[model samples]
Target: MKTEEHKMKKERWEKDMMLEHRRIEMEEQRLQWEQEQEIMFCDVTTMDDDQRAYVLAKRAKIAKAMSASVGETASGESGV
Candidate 1:
């Protein structure tokens, strides 16, 4: 029947639209992650010695805090 065929076409179109939106969202997220990676690993060769030292210190502080948080979580889970 023509009505049944029309309904099927509409459903397919909606499904295709959702897939396209999801692909666009995923690509945007990928680009955002790449930008963050670049910021974290930017070229130190273009920075002065003081700037490099500051960046390294900042990163080390973040690392220490992250490790401490992990240890806290593990101990809390074990009822310690």
Candidate 2:
């Protein structure tokens, strides 16, 4: 029936919209992460050797903590 067909089409359209929204959100998050990494790289470039090593160590510690919280290992494997 035409009414049933219309309902199916509407549901498909809504699901597609939701998927697109999620994709956009993921892309934004990726871009923000890349920007933060670039900023950190720039800071390291301006540092003396000891300062750079300290900053890198701090960054690594923070990364490990974040990965652990998300159930991932520091190497990015799932902590299964």
Provide the TM-score for each candidate, comma-separated.
0.55, 0.54
Regions of model 1 farther than 4 Å from truth? 44-80
lDDT scores in order: 0.78, 0.78
Scored by TM-score, the top model is 1
* Alpha-carbon lDDT of model 2: 0.78
Task: For candidate 1, write residues 1-80 as lDDT tens digits.
Answer: 99999999999999999999999999997996675566567788889999999777766765676678688887885312
Model 2 clash count equals 0
